[model samples]
Target chain A: MDTQGTFRQTVEPALVRRLQRGELAAFETIYRRFERAAWTLALRLTGRADVAQEVLQDAMLKAFERARQFRGDAPFAAWLRKLVVNEALMQLRHDRLHVIELFDETHADDDAPAPWAHADSATLDRALNRLPDAARAVLWLYHVEGYTHLEIAEQFGRSTSFSKSQLARATKRLRELLAPQAEDTPCTIGSTTTA
Target chain B: MHDRLDHHRMTGDASLAAALRALPASTPARDAWPELASRIRRRRVVRKAVWFTLPAAFAAGMALTLAWPHLQRSTASPAPVRVAMQSSSHATPPAAPDIDALQASSQQWQAWVQTLDRDGAPLDGRQLTQAVALQDRIGLVDLQLSAARNPSTTVGLWQQRITLLQQLGLLHLQPYLVATQRPASHDHLISM
Candidate 1:
């Protein structure tokens, strides 16, 4: 599928203009187009489907209210994604769920290959879900969302080292969780064979 | 040995990252549009109400503040001539031309009130109460002005009374102004 073409089709300038004029129908169109992607990102950030839904609604409303300010400098989808991230962070802050670890002491052991390196997406998602809020957020932003450590730090109001340390600890814990499963399954199929 | 370990870790990290990136974006179980639309509409209504109510409240507050001193002055000075003059002004035309002028002014006030009731915008409960209170205050100041022994004090009091009457008229007309002069964008709020 042509992903770029699909994205371009969803947020046409004409639709954006209509939304800027406070057209409810245009807003509904944008919501329908991006709701799944928004909800998924929100769910990942917040770790709760209910809270994710709330975040999606709030973020979309804010986007609609400030639609006039959108200068079309970036794709509307990207802007909306950023807004969802911001909303999710705000929800986390409000709930006091974002706990930042002060030190990288927990994952100081020798670097080891993640045992479940060859695990399917479901197992990986489960492992991700088990991570602490800050760790999960850092990993998602850094590895998945392509946010730089500095950007992650800015979002979380922490230093870049804070993002780095949280990511290290999260990766370590995920490896440990997947190690047991790796022991059961031989590292034969597409495994990073260790010497 | 260190280089081999680093290679293995890098491969593992790449594999893990791929799995995460492959995670499918899931659709929500329910449609959020209905709730979202309702919320947006409710917010617009609240904004419009605030836009209208604040100015009306301010006008009423200003009228009360301006009328308060005159109301107090009227009650303090119990002038018998003022009472007699007010009574004669309402009941009959005074023989004196100046007294007749006072009677005409009083009649004009009655006509103004009638015109406001007929032509002005309908008042909400709060505005109606303020208008009534202001009318009562105006009556008290009128009595006080009629009884003033000093011509200068009478003139000042008359001016204050006229200002109060104008304010009271505005207070009565405020709801109409809010309804008619509202911006077109606010129409969505009412329609919703």
Candidate 2:
């Protein structure tokens, strides 16, 4: 669509260039486009909407401060997501109990509708939320943010073994959560799919 | 049996992954953008101004100090030196109604005021006055020493005055001293 093409052109190249020059207007534009994505990630990581709001502001401020260093080689969205994630983790450390409480609530409310009840992929969301911070971060970066395990380890200041172990643990836990849901869905008699 | 186990694992993992993908996307709250922008702008201005002025201020101070030898040897009459010292020393004292009452204020109390400022703690107006009086005392002595016939004593007085001036410079940057100078460190930023 023309709208999609226009957004790509007007948003990416010009936006990156303007941000590189420290233009507030350009930053506002980027914020408007990506604020929801950043906030969602923050909320998921921290659980509380208030903490998410703080993370959003803190992340954007950091992004603006370091905007000059951002090379346009990576998509701005991915870079922004990483910043949001880092800020959320930093906030978690500061508050200490914020993420832990969220994790506990998620696990305790197994009977309650999953947090991502509105999504077609609700089961996966529940599984990811139940993960430990380090593991959850790796999974989100890998699947959602589209980073390689090697890249995730480098960003996390951990070795590749740690990154892989986290991913393995996340996958194992996800499988356990998804098994019940999978069983509940009645198998169609005419379905050719083996599972 | 192996094939069945593989199917169960793969399908379950995929389902969980999809659910994870589906966690509701959140929109950023509206109020944060402007506040963050303001903070960034404030920090940038403070850092840049500090960098530029800190070096220049240090350089000018060192140049003046280095020129001390030449200026001292040039045996001008005491009249010109007296006039310069008087002009520089003309800073008005605190306009407290009870100047005499404050004159007897202990130097220890005044030093506490200075210490509070150095530690980035707030001081009361009375304490501020005491600190100012102490600074004035040092400055006056330095001016007098500059005009003195005794060279060794003059050097000692100037050194003491410089130390006081350095303290004032650091204090000027404190948040409480917003009405004064905005602290932007350049050369000896860490020391300041």
Candidate 3:
């Protein structure tokens, strides 16, 4: 239902002005409003709740400091999201935790249905969390965050093919992990579910 | 056949992407506000401390710069002046031509420094340290000029003093200059 657009509309100009004026209450309001989304993005990127919490706090503080730089041209949520993403990337780099696997050149059989096609969101989330840091990050950025391959490549300091390959590998691995369970379950009645 | 299969794969991938996008943002396990608020408070306090401390340091540096020459002059025996006068007895004393000028120049710079000390209430820590070091150098140069043995040496030292004074004046006037150039905007608070 155009959730992102609706979320952007919720942040009133008056509220932003209050935040710009260094009002703690205004900042707190912003924090409560977006903290969950920020935390989720962080968790997806970092794959650890502890690290995600740290990234969330750091990014929120940075947002508070740079609030005056918010030109009001972009959605406040988008701006905050950028900060969170940057912070999560920085934290990952600082921790030296990036684990990029070489993309396997062999393609998976295209006719095979994706096991995760009908998996519950929670199950999908757990499977995503199992991915290597780099694969998960690329997957999240490309799919969930709506960043293009070029954008993901730029963010990761890699080539577009690198992003493409990482996404492929991630999706392949996720499907493999879910396929066995899907085959065992009696609910696998149709070949229509692909993802 | 390959084209149709690729299309089917694309559709499946698109559905997967949609599902991923639709996943709800999970709530953090604990409330992050109390800690976040404390961090913001701590940062504000640190910023305020820096703001207050920096100007005070700049003022102290200005004071030291202004008072340094006088302190040095008071401590030294007039032996250097006596020696210079005795050494150049055949010619006009090197000190006679430049001492008054030097003292006046020093006083002028001192006045400028005092004005800055009064006004430089917003100088940051780095700027204050720079001002202090510049002032100390000026005092050292003044001492060197006062001890010059020849007219040539005195002229060089006088030139050095003028240059140093020019720099010190610029350094001292920095805060006022910056303030005038950029009328305080709300954006300034954001940087801190």
Superposing all C-alpha atoms, what RMSD in Å does each candidate have to the true structure? 11.0, 12.2, 10.2
The worst-scoring run of ten residues by lDDT in candidate 1 chain A lies at A186-195
- After the best TM-score superposition of candidate 2, give how far the Cα of residue B45 lies from its true spot, in angstroms: 2.3
**lDDT (0-100) at residue A3 of candidate 2?**
22
Q: Write the per-residue lDDT of candidate 2 for residues B4-101, one digit (tens) a residue.
A: 76675555445545555545564544657778778777666656555654565465457546655554443233756655664688652322222222
TM-score winner: 3
DockQ of each: 0.21, 0.20, 0.22
Could you tell me the lDDT of residue B95 within candidate 2? 24
Candidate 3, position B30, lDDT: 86
State, as a TM-score between 0 and 1, how close model 3 is to the true structure.
0.66
**What is candidate 3's CA lDDT for residue A63?**
90
lDDT of 3 by residue, A1-195 (tens): 544311343688899999999999999988888877788889889988899999999889879888998998878888888888877877775674555666567887777787677776666777787788888888888877888999878676679998888888888888876676566753433321112
| Candidate 1 lDDT by residue in tens digits, A44-144 | 78777788889999889878987887889888887788888888877776675556544446553456655555665555666677787888888888887
Model 1 residue B122 distance off true place after TM-score fit, in angstroms: 23
TM-scores, all models, native as reference: 0.64, 0.59, 0.66
Worst 10 residues of 3 chain B by lDDT: B183-192
Better model by lDDT, 2 or 3?
3
Candidate 3 lDDT (Cα, whole model)? Answer: 0.72
Q: In candidate 3, what are the lDDT values of residues B1-192, reduced to their tens digit?
A: 989998988887887788787666677888999999998886675466446545754564575467546644543447678666657786644445344555555566566556556654456788788878887887898798778775545655655665676676667656544533422332222221
